[model samples]
Target: MNPGASYQTELAQKLQCFFSDQQQGLDIPPAQLYRIEGFIEAGLLAGFITELGLKQTLVDSAKQYLNVEVADFYQQDYRLILHMRMHEAPVYPSSNPPCPQS
Candidate 1:
């Protein structure tokens, strides 16, 4: 697969596993649920979904499927940092010709 496709797949798998694990036995409040749902939706909009991955079908599917409500304690700043890391630009080696021999 292409590098972009591979990266997306890896991201989707990580997200799926993370959310699924979070859904184990947690009881989340409604307000926190809303925040969790928003975060998942943002991920979807940012192209984090796959054929069998997170989607916008219902109001609480993110909670039901990914269970991000567990992370509600994370502040906005922390979430932003995570988001930036996930979408960080790739670095490439400098292409300038090697300095001419003295």
Candidate 2:
């Protein structure tokens, strides 16, 4: 599978499993699942985008949405550079025990 599609599928499956395990006795319907999935999907996209260093696309989109120039759009948020670079390291969530660090 393409990497992006694989990531999205994994994220959706995680959300499904989380809701399933949480709502064992209660009635969790498809609508609720979809809402929760929407939130999770948005978060996942933002996190992945940040990790993959898509600052220009993010900034350009923000500018279009907010009706501002690129410079003005970034004036108050210069740290997006650091965020998408230094602090955006990818994190793999694994259920298995971690291997010994050599």
C-alpha positional error of residue 29 in candidate 2 after TM-score superposition, expressed in Å: 23
User: Best-fitting candidate, measured by TM-score?
Assistant: 1
Cα-based RMSD of candidate 2:
16.7
The Cα local distance difference test for each model comes to 0.44, 0.47
The lowest-lDDT stretch of 10 consecutive residues in candidate 1 is 78-87
- The most accurate candidate by lDDT is 2
Cα lDDT, model 1, residue 81? 18
TM-score of every candidate relative to the true structure: 0.32, 0.27
Error of 1 at 11 (Å): 0.6
Tell me the tens digit of each residue's lDDT in model 1 across 1-102: 875567556555554544454445343345544655565555556665432243322213344564354233222123321211122346999999889998
lDDT at position 23, candidate 1:
49
Error of 2 at 63 (Å): 33
Candidate 1, backbone clash total: 0
